[model samples]
Target chain A: MKKLWISLTYLVFIVLLIIPLIRIFSGSWAEGWEGFVEALTRPQSLHALWMTTIIVVSVTLLNTIFGVMLALYLVRATWLGKRLKQLLNSLVDLPFAVSPVIGGLMIVLILGPNTIMGVFFEDIGFKVVYALPGMILATLFVTFPLMVREVMPVLQEIGTQQEEAASTLGAYSWYTFWKVTWPSIRWGVIYGVVLTVARSMGEFGAVLVVSGNIMNKTQTATTLVYQDVENFNVLAANSVALVLAAVSVGLLLLMEWAKKRKGH
Target chain B: MHIEVSNLNKHFGDFHAVRDVSFTIEKGRLIGLLGPSGGGKTSILRMLAGLESPTSGDIVFHGKKVNELPPQERGIGFVFQNYALFKHMTVYDNIAFGLKVKKQSKDQIRERVMSLVELTGLKGFEHRYPHQLSGGQRQRVAFARALAPEPQLLLLDEPFAAIDAKIRHELRTWLKDMIERLGITSIFVTHDQDEAIEVADEIMIINKGRLEQKGSPWDIYKNPQTQFVASFIGESTIVEDVSKLKGFEDASVWPGTKALIRPEYIEVGKRSEFRIASATEPGRVKHIHFRGSEWMVEVTVGDTTLITYRSLEKEVLQPGDEVSVLVHRAYLFNDNDSWIMENKLKEDPMPIHI
Candidate 1:
């Protein structure tokens, strides 16, 4: 009975996953290579894709490093900063709880020429609002928690024993970190980075608020998709949405693969 | 290779984990730092290895102050209770890690690791990760790793705790041979008195962040200085009436005192010689546990059940024999025993770590 139930579950999973890919494959069948070529060569469409890739890659790299550092700091540090660390750790879900538009607005309010950061940056001939930096800030805010969430528990569970053992064995702190500590957390960090990339790719609301949706440079894939729909270009919007979906599905699958390899 | 821990202290928030623990260990000695759980054995080892800082004192290794040094800078190898092997690395890499960190020549590292692995009976298992090894095998790997570095001092934090009972004795004997062969000053932390007796040159019984006694294992076993040491090191039947021993003038015997006796030392004799209130019964023997040399006999002493092990060569008492047990070489400790007062531990001996 248990075997029968397991087989049935797998059968259902295959159907659920394969059905969508089949629809996607079948949907693009009529359009073929000509549509694919057109989608790739079109300047506005292709440039938007390039911008999206850049935003996702840059924002994700920044978030992964900072997130891991934050996790290490929170776990290892003993000071008056602990209460603050707890508050910051819980701040990961701030994006999920608050609307993305509000997060964007808060950045604008705090650093948009009228606020102290904005006023200070203005004096230095820099701007956060209506700029690429602003877009990064939005993505960073949304994705900050991903890597930390992945890495912290692994660090906690695997613990300082191996690291301390390494240290006592004559490896300096940094050597112990890379040699003993990093291997255990590397998979978790990769999963986090992959998630951050996917989330940044489809990040729309806050980037829309901050980017001002500049047609060629600042507009990201999700923002461009929104722009296309608003401009009554439904097919173009569908194309970009499908691309985002494809990337997300591909990376999520990569995460699953890494997880399987680790499980073994 | 004398290692001295001077005024080493650690605090976890308001709780003082180790308080002013100080001990001097001579070279080529295997000392067991014995304590019950939460007695701060692990903390003291961590400080000695520089994994933790002494909140107030200094550690001197071979006449050099090492308190400010980080763990890696202190050429000491520590084995954790669970044997914290580098899981991602193969057994070869795990054993060679300490030497490699010191940038030993590759050939030297290989030779050292291979020899240790061979010694540990893990020769063919070099390529396997920690997960692929059994608990006993993992413990050997930990020992191999610690020994690979040729440390002046080796610290083992309850290395045999994770093994199954059947393997514990065998593994412990193997460890004793290895540590003895190395001739490195070593301190092992354990709460089990049997393990300490089997392996250590000296045993220091700790209770509530204080050392109760530091002496040869035999000194501790035969003449436990404190009640805390007596109970923690071995199973003892302590009678509060020890101060009322036949001799009253001895300074060793004090008022409100107790006599702690290990059951094995108690010899059964006739009713005429029995001092404590006693009773005898005739009933079918329910059970006996076979301990290689002796058989632990369980019999009814009236309403209460008592256990006493006699030589296996001695005639096995039949199901319905009336027998008497005698108390010999019982330890006397000052009584007025209260756990709260015991923890207060006034004028306690300083902790010593080698």
Candidate 2:
């Protein structure tokens, strides 16, 4: 009975994962290596890839800093009242609850060029909507919870005893955090960063809505793939997706390594 | 450094953890905050270490008020329960953390850390992480780490609670000797009565967030001022209506009082062996426990059960056997105060004959 169940699971996994991955890998090289190179070297394709890299780097950095800070505040800040902490804690999972498309729409509505804050920013000579900033913001919205969720449990697990021990040893708060707290949570932060990077790389609905899928100005890798699919350019879309899938697989491996280190 | 705390109170929301606790410690004295769990002994220790602020009180060290001072400025060494060693850093780095934070030169840090490592008996294990070391080794590293910065005082919260029984006993003696040799005023919190009595120069008993008593172990054992102290300080059984027991008939004058009988105060022996057999009450052995070095025999005289320890040199006692039990002393206490009551038969060992 157990063998039958195990075989059933393997069948489902191969059908759902291995088959699709193989199809994409073969589809990307339908025109051979020269055609694949040609598809990826187009100015629009290169720009989209570059934009994705910029978004991934910016989002990962911002998310790591802010997410870790928020997790620490939620777990360690005694000044926050119980109700307020609970409210803020639930608010952290908002990105996971709301659809990314709706998240992008909310940002556009709140910070679009016609809005008061948007016009004020434009008056100061900074473009937000349908630009690099908006694309980054959209990806940030979808990936914010990934880092926080990964780091929050780690912060909670380490507790405040070591920090207290450090303080009583004549170390200041900042020194205690860097010496005692940072080393303990670094693995968790690394895991969070990997998740955030992967999420930002593959973010599609939000970035498309916010970036307006501009060919060179703000189009990201996933958005360019969407545009190609919409225009019946299956080969181009497959080529870009193959790159995303490869990076995601690498991040998965990195995440597993981080998880093992954190177990120690 | 001499330390004084006055009217210290701590409240976690509506729950009062420490209430009106006041005490003073002389310089170089090793004090023990001894109490049951959740009795606020740790709260008092943390407040002294500046880890927790008192709700309303003043902590004065060397005649300087430090209620507003942070733990870093207070210059205290705190050893947490379970050691709380830095798992990531090697033993050497863990000990050098405070020195590095104080901006000591690398040479000075190395010099201090090496000496501490030697003092703590962790000489060869400097490069191992906390997880790689045993519980006792980790505790020593915590001690060395705390001592590296040369703090004015030291605080340990349940220092031996995480170690095994044998190691705990060894560490207790080692810690007591080390603290005395260094002449560093230290305070440790422990729920184990044996640990506190055996190691502390003075033990402060805490109960229900209040300071019950503070004295030398022997002094507290001989003279317990409060009912709580009388019952808490040793292995005792609280017996009501003490006047019902033989030789305690005069105790009836203190109505509504309870008597605490410690095992050492009661002697159980064979009827033929006791010289004062007339004064000794006949009791039935209800249960016998084989302690490592002694036999703990429980005897029931009339309706009351009394506990007494018997020597292994004497004839073995068995359950359901008839024996003569003579209680030399028992502490009688009411709600507010306590006093010792001696067996009146002891005054007249030989009875008058007609």
Candidate 3:
């Protein structure tokens, strides 16, 4: 009886998940692969793909480094006061609760045209909103928590004994970290970066609120999909959406592999 | 290197860990920091290893102050209670890590690591990861890894505390042999007095962050200088009130002084055979325990019970048998807890009031 119930629940979950994925794939190729190829080949769509890749990759790289350092400081270093550390730890989860659009609006409120930061940037001949930087900032704000949350528990689990052992063995601080500490936390970093990449790739609400949806420039893959559907280019929209879904699935698979590799 | 810990004190917030402790250790001797749990033995070891800073004292090494030195620059090898072997690395890599960090050539690192693995009895398991090895094997790996850089001083924090009980004695003997062969100045912390007595060239007994005594195993065992050391270092019967002893009233020992008599020093026989010449006390044998070559007889006298070891050659003593105990040697400590002297009860009891 238990086995039958478990199998029924598993079937329902798989069916619920797989039906949309099948519809997505077949709907994107409804007009045949030729139309799919042609829509993807359009210059604007091509530029959006490139822009999305650039933003996601840069965000993943920067967030991976920052996440590991922040997790290390939180777990191992004692530079902050107790209350400040707790506050910072709490703030690490801000992106989790806040909507992506509101995060983008927050950036705008601080760096938009009327604000002091916006005026300073404008005087310096730099643009934050309606630019590639604005989209990147939105993606960064949405994906910042992925890496830190993944690495913090792993760092706490490994503890400082190995690091202390390394130091007592005459290893300098950096050498001890790179040698003794990094190997233990490498899987966690990989898992974090993978999540960060996937989240940044699919981030839409924040990028839409900040980048102004400029074509051939600030328009990312997600925004381009929206623009294609608005202009009645259904095939173009489906093609870009399918590609984004595939990339996200690929990242999800990588994350699963990393999680398995770091099993208890 | 010779090490000196002078007036070393450490405070963690409001808790005092190590008090005003001073000791000088000679070079190339294996010393044991023996104490009860939470007695600050480990803290003193950490202070010497530079893992912790003394709040108000200096640690001098070879006549130079080392209080400001980091653990790495202090050149000390430390083995933690958990071993703390690198879980991700094989035995070879873990042992070779320090030499590699020192930028030694590949061949030199391999040579040094192989020699250490051989020395530590880890030659057959160099490729095994820490998690893959047994507790004893992992402990040896931790020791090898710590010794790879040729540290001047070696500190072990309860190195055998985590191992199986059956293997503890084996490791203790092996470690004593290894340390003596290397001739390194080493100090290890342990709460087990037996391990300290068997393994260390000298034992420093600590209690409540205070130094109770420091002497050789023979000296400390035979003549513990304080009540705490005497009671802690050996299995002895402590008579709280010396006035209760049958002949102790005339020995110039005061009312509240405590006398420690080792089980081997107390002779047991039938009550009728006990003469009044010696300090003979009558008691009922409450229990009899077989200790291989000897019988451990617990006798209840007055309001206290004392453990005495009798040879197997004697007649078997039952639980309800009445027996008299003769004290051949007893060390008396005053109410102030300092050693007074060793008293040998004689056949002719004389009045000695001084």
Candidate 4:
């Protein structure tokens, strides 16, 4: 009976997850690899992939630096009061808790052409909403907590003893951080960046609200998939989505590998 | 370096950790700050190492004030209780970290680190990370890493607390020798009285954020200046209200003062053999514990119980045996726990009438 129950549970898992994934993969190749390749090679689709790569790379890079700084401040520095520390700690997860569409709307409201800051940017001849900058801001807003959450637990685990030991060994503050603190948290930062890339690559709701989904201009891979599906171009939609799925799968594998390595 | 800490006080929000703690250290001597957990020993060590600023006191290092200097500028080497070796770095790199940060040439750093590796007996293990090393080896790495910068003074917080008990003694002796060989002033914090007594040149005992007493190990053992020090550093039976005892109600005795009687000073023997048999108080042996090399016999004298040690090779005394206990020496402290005077009990010739 126990064996039967366990096998039934495994069957349920496969039916719920593996079936849909297999259907998507087989459906995308209904015509052939040639048609899928053709869909990915189109100028508009190519531009979407490029836009995604730009947003994902830039957002991950910026957040990695800021995230590590924030984690260090939260874990090591004692300058803030207990209540303020708790407030900052809770606020780090704001990106995770807020809906990505709402986050995008928040960005648009602040940087839209009609707002004071938006007019100031317009006077400076810089476009924000319905542009690359606005899309990047939305992506950044959704991915801000990835690196910090990954690094914070590791920082708290490693503690400040090594840094204190470094200082007592005549190491200056910056050198101590670079030599002692950074190495311990490097793997955590890498894991966070991997997750950040995966999240930003698939981000649609927020980027769609901000980018206006202009073809060959502000369209990202996810938005392009949505547009292709709306136009009943199933092959184009499946192909663009397949690329993101592949990247996400690869990153998930990398995260698993990192977890195993950390175990050792 | 000779260091002087005057009126050091540390308060962590509402908790007063270290209060008015002051002490002076002579150059090139190893000192131990002995206290229980949350007793402010670590706080004092941190203040001395410039890790934590004292709320209202001055730290003078070699005649120069260093209260405002950061830990890196304090010219002090600190070894954390867990050793805090850089886990990601090789032993060689960990030792060379400070020199590298100081911008020494690559060759110079290598030379210094290699010498430390040999000095710390870690030559073959220099390529391994901290995780690969044993507790004792990791402790040596921390010591070498701290010493690489040629710090004026060394501060260690519970250095042996992480090591295996079997090797802890060996490491303490080795550390003491290494510190003496280096001829640098050093201070370590430990809660273990035996560790402090066995390793340190001078022991400063602290309790509840207050400095109880500071002296050489023998001096502290023989002459603990406070009731807390007497009870903490070694075992003793505290007799409160000495007037309640049979022979201790003399007018010369301070009224209602507490007295500390060390176990070793209370000899257990037959009453007839005592020089002044009248002064020997009769007691019952409540229990006898074999301590491998000796026997610790618990004697119930009147309303108090005192622990007295006997040699394992001696004739075994069983429980419920009636014995006579002679008080050889005791130290009296005032009700406030401050030391007053040592009383060497003179044998009374006349038998006391109850």
Positional deviation of residue B197's Cα in model 3 after best superposition, in angstroms: 0.7
Determine the iRMS, in angstroms, of model 3. Answer: 0.8
After superposing candidate 4, which stretches have Cα over 4 Å from the reference?
A: A1-16, B244-247, B251-253, B336-354
- When summed lDDT is taken over every stretch of 10 residues in candidate 3 chain A, the lowest stretch is A74-83
> Which is the better candidate, 2 or 4, if ranked by DockQ?
4
True contacts kept of 1: 0.98
| Tens digits of lDDT, candidate 3, A1-264 | 999999999999889988777776887898898988998999998999999999988898889888888888988776577888899999999998999999999988988888999889989999998887878888888998888899899989988888888889988889988888888888988989888888899899999989988899889999998998899987788888899989888888998999998774
Put the candidates in DockQ order, highest first.
4, 3, 2, 1
Model 3 CA lDDT for position A139: 88
Question: CA shift at B231, candidate 3, in angstroms?
Answer: 1.9
Residue range B105-199, candidate 4, lDDT tens digits: 99999999999999999989989999999999999999999999999999999999998899999999999999999999999999999999999
lDDT of 4 by residue, A1-264 (tens): 999999999999999988867866876798899988899999999999999999998998888889889888988789888899999999989988999999999988999888999899988999999999999899989998888899999989988889998888887778888888888787888888888998999999999999999999999999999999999998888888888888888999999987766554
Looking at model 3, the pairs that clash are none
Candidate with the larger TM-score of 1 and 4: 4
lDDT of 1 by residue, A94-151 (tens): 8878888888888888888688889899889888888888888988888887888888
Report lDDT (CA) for all predictions. Answer: 0.78, 0.91, 0.87, 0.88
Q: List iRMS (one decimal) for every candidate.
A: 0.9, 0.8, 0.8, 0.9
Model 4 CA lDDT for position B104 = 98
lDDT at position B329, candidate 1? 48
Residue range B1-354, candidate 3, lDDT tens digits:
999888999998789999999999999999999999999999999889888888998899999999999998998999999988888899999999889989999999989999998899887898998888999998999999889999999999999999999999899999999999999999999999889999999999999999989999999887788888888977888777655666566545366667787887777887665555356777789999998888999988788788888878877889998778776667787767565443345455766567
